[model samples]
Target: MIAILSDIHGNLPALEAVIADARTAGATAFVNLGDSLSGPLWPAETADLLMREGWPAIAGNHERQVLTHAIERMGASDRFASERLSAAQLAWLAAQPPVLALTDEIFLCHGSPRSDLEHLLHTVEAAGIRQATEAEIAERLGDTPAALTLCGHTHLPRTVTLADGRTIANPGSVGLQAFHDDHPLPYIVENGDPLARYALVRGTGVELRAVAYDHLGAAAKAAREGRADWAAALRTGLAG
Candidate 1:
């Protein structure tokens, strides 16, 4: 099966838990849709882990930041906060491709095919979603043949079949849950907590799995990093 993940945002613990879960499920290969950096901690570490694990990952907006930082650093220009990342990390991020056409019928991107920063969530109105899907298909597929497009940026898990029969999938954030005040829980909670979220895509079927991990630990990490907003949201799963 294809193990798809995205929007990790540098949460090593959450990523580790997701990886462990995916491994247990016997996923032969992994496809990462990016946003691997920029979070409470471990941006460089997360990139390193993905490299060491030999997983193929596409570049996200954050990765573009890293690349821009490197260019600025080389030119002796002021770098953004993220540009302060380690040289090794910058190199690794720079090396990542913006998109991955995995096979003749599968395409992976950090966002929409039209833009690396686009948000392709299925929660939108059908007309809007259809418009976006058609535009993406035209740009990426272009009559090459039918292909499965996988993307992540909205941090919301979704699987949609457009009016023209094109398929799009977003596995959501492996480290952060989509904002929902009522849910008030990050994707994963501690053992048997039933809050962790993930998606499995094999062939024409997509299965979303919300398991439990250690919310307390994740929250503590956020707190330790002085990201009160994130920590609070971890409890409520609300972005703001």
Candidate 2:
């Protein structure tokens, strides 16, 4: 079985908890879907841990933006995340691809195969997030023929089946659970708790899992790093 994770966003405690839980749940292999260190908790430390594990990962929109976008074009959070990384870590992150194929049956990408910034299965409505129609999602998927396509960017756990029976999974965020983003549109992502999220795929089935960790500890780390917003998000999984 393989544990697929995404949007870890530098919360080492949360990532550790999710990995431990996945191990206990019989996952032997791991794939990361990116946005691994774009938060205030511990970008370099998180990257080092993942590097030590040698898990293959793709680049999320955050990763692309942080690496390629000019500093003047970056948001406050992006600037904050970029400043905390070492030159070596930055180089490593810049090297990750936006899309990867693990096998004939599995393909991994941050947001979608077409664009790292587009949501494959979600539309940002005024009320909140709405699941895109099957055709809409399939259009976003384009010509990829992988049976299972994994993506993450919105930090929400999701699974969708296209009309052709292909499955798309958003394993969700492993670290930061709640936040506001303004890239493609203004939207908020919250899971109602500061729990690490990932997914395990075995045989032909997928199981989304949330692993609770030391939220206060992560919050403390964020506070120490001068990110009160992150501290608050860690304490309460809300954009407020």
Q: What would you estimate as the lDDT of candidate 2?
A: 0.86
Residue 142 lDDT in candidate 2:
92
Residue by residue across 125-210, what tens digits does model 2's lDDT show? 77767777888889999999999999998888989987788999998889888887765667787788888889999954789998
- Displacement of residue 195 (Cα, Å) in model 2 is 0.9
Q: Spell out the clash pairs found in candidate 1.
A: 184-236, 187-195, 187-196, 188-196, 189-213, 190-213, 196-211
Query: Which 10-residue span in candidate 1 carries the lowest summed lDDT?
Result: 182-191
Best by TM-score: 2
Q: With candidate 2 superimposed using the best TM-score fit, by how many Å does residue 210's alpha carbon deviate from the native? A: 0.5
Indicate the TM-score of model 2.
Answer: 0.94
Task: Give the per-residue lDDT of model 1 (tens digit) for 62-117.
Answer: 67765665554432111322644677777777788987788877888886666675
